[model samples]
Target: MGKIVFKRLVEVQILHDYFLTMGDGISFFQRNKKEKEELLTQRINRGLYSAGSIFKISPITANKLRDNKILFAETSSGFILGVEVDEVIEAGELRFKPVHDISKKLDLSFSLTTKLPFFKSFTNLELEKSLPSINYFTNKKATLLNENTVPAYTSMPLTKTAPAHQAGETYEMGTILDFGGTIREANQRTDGNDPAHWEDIDDRRFVTRADKVLLPHNFKIKFKDYQLVTQLEVSLEDTGNNKIKKIVKNSAEPFKDISLNFSKIDENDKDSPNIPSGIYYLNLKINGATEIVYSILLDNDLYDYQNFGVVELGFEEVNSPYSLLDTQGFLKTKIEAGGQKVSHPIFEIRLKNRRSYWRYKKNTDFTPSEIAATSNHLEVAASNILVAKKPKALTETLLPFKNGTNLLLPTPKVAGIRVENEKIYSDIHINQSNGLLKI
Candidate 1:
């Protein structure tokens, strides 16, 4: 397979005053010219060295350098000679003037091989002197010799500890890669990698599971009713530090139920408390005598009691002396009050096989509105016959029933009527006065 190559070409201008030679190396002027030439040469060499050093220490550059796939070159443009021309009128006579001079600027070009086509441009040679000096080899011996430091290898075999890279795995930017002593960062993420899809985080400054953090939680403890325990005491102690975060104590009259509540408190506002997620011990005392302890985990928000009341309904067949009735059913309903009282309750009965026979005229024997009209009649009949009363006080008005009890609902008067006919003609009409029908 062919190898990928990257090239960086840089060209900079150097002013004549910086590297011009005055005379040969013989007289005082000659010595000054030689010194100036030496200084200029040193500056140019340093600039080239700085540029190469910056790229050499790069992770990709170092890897390529190890494989002997890198190159560096520098070139200078030869002296450029040119002439300037101008039109002049000297002594009322038009004349053409020409002046010859050498350019006062020197062009220097530098080229370096890189693993990636990423480079910075320098407008002039002075800018190169401003580049910061970075010593990749920080060791005393390595710095003195102007050489890169190499790690000492051991005879022991190296073990592969890192897991193999899996497909679709993503890593976040600024992820550090430690190559024994040298460290580099994966700063670019132009590929299919995104920090949002990263699974694991090595930084402790970020929170991973926000829901697991401790927040304000409501708790309530109620003593059984009609018991000797009229007082209750509750306290929550942090298991890690044995610190008492919250405490509550309450008392009630004799034979009365006692309830104690505890929660995280914030003095400034009642929003949330600054609690840490951990295990806590909940201590409870009944009548300031009986003590009980329980362990609870407070990693998530919790509520002690149900918010909505529950209603349960049960149905059972009952014996009926009326032979015309197919079956008699009784409804047994129970309502359990929760944190709040329920003033109104709604009960719905659904027929699984109910179809739009009245609107669609599925039954040709019956009129289109027969089912709809009969439903209204049955509802009125049921309201008139069905009466709710307390089982103990049979004559009393309907009241809230907290416990399960049987309800007596009499059959409606319209239940025995046959709403559908066998084969009734559409034009048939009945004479109300004589009770005779014409078909």
Candidate 2:
């Protein structure tokens, strides 16, 4: 019952990749359109908000802490809290040596401290609060933490996909497993026989902007067959032939999960058609369970929709209600320039968190209080993805779009996120067309 050690990249050095397809995502969304649409309603709503293909990374060489291996100072994008440093410096070539305001707030102006010829130093691992939580660079520590280890879900493809500046931003499906969910394979029976148990989500990711949404309803599933969670269905993935055609049966949930107080997304359905952000997936069959598929990014970043618009901060799925403003369970808020085209994509989704709670440390049979009383229960058990909408105005072109609505956007009424701290704090809803949205 003991073998969880994971965290490895061994080497690093990539130095370039800043792609952004579709004529630069359509000239960065027609010069950040959304000044309230209108270019004749964006040429009569074409492709709702087209633009795809994304990449953004720049690392030349890093990782070299020798010993057993563990050097991560300026390159380790998200979630790898192997924490426990004592010597691993390079903070990008040292240079902050200013001291004097009673010291503690961080000081280093660097006139020439220690060894600053080309940079290289070690011994400072108390990680001042894991160095500002994340977006790492280890504070720019440069690199060092080598002990070489891996096995606990070692998918390190860059922490299992979605970085490189999110390869061009656009996501939404939120059942909480980030990198847009859907990477299962280790669950040899929830832990008994030791299979590195994995599966967890709190569901609540909002880059917000509504054209009518309300059908997802908080489904924190763990699956062992809670009625297959009502045979759950949601479908919307055709990602150019990835296949997943139909079955969104109007906000599904009926096969049976005994309605653990279900809500199907805060009341919405006014003629549906306003789901045009991007990235969505969630489908489950329910037999012996584990069919899995979950992802959601929905950034209403219509090219910076408007002043750092969809700036979400903290809370990705645990007891949602915004994870109680995340005292520290994962709190982030980014979007540097204007809401979607910003430099902070919520720190690219809080730098892709996973530092700890590696889904209850990849459960080997549960015992950290029964895997924290059942891996944070986020029961969705079954669902689907994607929904695009367009042609709902300019006097309608030919309504009836449904089998997966095309012409470029036509899929509203998907509302499925909740983070209650009560008196409902925070607000932001802008639908533009379609309708209904009560979050």
Candidate 3:
């Protein structure tokens, strides 16, 4: 009887394909029929698919279904009835792991190959926002973690320092020691004899007021994405620090080992949408000592425009035989920021004539070549001489001094003045800033 009923339900395939497929078909007929519908209703309710439905089947029934000896068919009332089956299989035999199965099944369709590039790793924010920071070891004892932070704390002890502005200057925190000495003219010279003299231009001396001296607040910055091309412009003057100053004193010792660290204080800015963006704290350290520390709110618009000055290479036509003592040449280049024109200083170069070499008037066509030759000779001569005795007793800038006052070649060292053949090159002395030689 069950087999006959199931066979009859199977014949309703036409209805199942057309209308019975709409949603839960059994529920639709329940409203139309007020009285109980007997076996049809019970089967319909029991056949609903649910997570728990699999457990309701008896072991015998499950085995019969699995073996295809008995099956179910749909009726016009959206109900299932016992029916015969033609296929038999365990469910586990057909099941598969989703990820593995999809790849294996579609490998041919997807064209599996190792040529595809794999993503290496996410962008590093810390490296991108890297900036210089003042680092130092503790000189005193520490009780806490006793490691990294302790050394830093002791070196940059949180002592209050007099404001640089107290003397009408913006001072960094902790920089309490004020070198009250007036800005004396720094002597720039070198001796050719000593290898150390080549870097003598950087040596400098300053007297500071002990009472007013204090540690400057440290400043540092870390670029979240790009590198910050840092240039230090320190002004010991009252007008404020120069952002671009080429002269690094103390054999470049004063400018060495300067560190700055920057931290994002504002995380809400769209431009700096990450951790630190709009505002940040800057930590600056010099020679393992904290110089200044302060918070700075950055304006993206600040660098929108660049302030620049044009450097023009000034040249004058002169007779080839004439001694070109130290003719200054000039070229125009621009440096700008924030759409404003910046005041550019003067440009100059110092060169000494090596010898009087005559050029044929017919060969005037080689003007560029002649200019290059003349430039090279003057450079070689200027580099070989010792210091200018008139300028200073020490050889700040060694020049190629001639034996006689005639400025001739084969010149010996002026006894009182210590001069050597340093072999300075013109290209090495060419200053990019303001486009001129200071001497």
Best by TM-score: 1
User: Over the stretch 215-276, how does candidate 2's per-residue lDDT look in tens digits?
Assistant: 22223333232233444444445334353333432225434232211222222555544444
lDDT score for residue 171 of model 2:
22
In order, the Cα lDDT scores of the candidates are 0.25, 0.22, 0.21
Model 1 ranges off by over 4 Å: 1-216, 252-262, 265-273, 299-439
Cα error of candidate 3 at position 64, Å? 89
Candidate 3 achieves a global lDDT of 0.21
lDDT of 3 by residue, 91-207 (tens): 322111111111111100000011112100110001111222111111012112111221221111111121121222121111122223211111222211222221121101111
Better-scoring candidate (TM-score), 1 or 2: 1
In model 2, state the lDDT of residue 200: 41
Instruction: Give the Cα-based TM-score of candidate 2 against the true structure.
Output: 0.18
How far off is residue 326 in model 2, in Å? 21
lDDT of 1 by residue, 1-439 (tens): 6433222211211222212222221211122324533654664565521323222211222332233322323233111111223334444433322222211121111112222121111100111111111111100111011112123111110111112222332222323222233332223221233333222312111101111112224433333333455555666777664656545445456534332233444434677675554456666665666555554444332211111101111111122211101131111111223323211111111001100111111212333243233342222212212111211111112222122233212211111111122110111122233211111
User: Where does candidate 1 clash, by residue pair?
Assistant: none
Query: TM-score, each model?
Result: 0.19, 0.18, 0.18
